[model samples]
Target: MKFLKQFGIILGVSFIGEVLKYFIPLPIPASIYGLVIMLLLLSVKIVSVEQVKDTGSYLIEIMPVMFIPAAVGLITMWSELKSLWFPLCVITVVTTVIVMAAAGRVTQFIIRMEKRQKE
Candidate 1:
């Protein structure tokens, strides 16, 4: 029952994301919109972490299983991917590094802000 409620809330937020994506001119994906909405809601105390924690944790635990289909698709496209492997690898590495750096900087900034607030 609790899982169902949490899952429903998540789905409702995702539905709003889909609606926004349909009406908006931006190129961002619906899933990203949904994530941003979820974050905003949590930040504003409109949604408590405790409400979604169980379901969210469960989904994370099963996330690898969700990648199986994508992995299989990649394997099936091995020949095509091989031809584009160099560019694909370069893009992946570049994006990964950029994201890591951005996340690290954001984390450091947030920690510094929190420490300053405490003092």
Candidate 2:
């Protein structure tokens, strides 16, 4: 009943997004486009929060489960992964460190700018 209604809204928005993708040449993912559309609808009060809250929460709860198949596929390809493990490890570590450092610097810069603005 309630679940069906919420599901219908999600489906309708997703379908609209897919239809829009055909006309738009954006490089972004269609599902992401759908999400932005949904957000815009909520912001404009075109879609009530209560209408989608239950279904949205349910989807969030099951989001991790959606990755199970991908995980299993990765596991099955473990041997191939092991062959490239060294380069992968190096790239992962270097990228992670670079990203963390950049994020921290950006945060500090933002905070300093805000303080200077306040003064």
Writing each residue's lDDT as its tens digit, candidate 2 over 41-63 gives: 99999999999999999999999
lDDT of 2 at 61: 100
Worst 10 residues of 1 by lDDT: 77-86
Tens-digit lDDT track for model 1 on 1-119? 99999999999999999999999989999999999999999999999999999999999999999999999999999988999999999999999999999999999999999999999
Clashing pairs in 1: none
Deviation of model 2 at 76, angstroms: 1.8
Q: Which structure among the candidates has the greatest lDDT?
A: 1
Query: Which regions in candidate 1 have their CA more than 4 angstroms from the true location?
Result: none
**Cα lDDT of all candidates, in order?**
0.97, 0.94
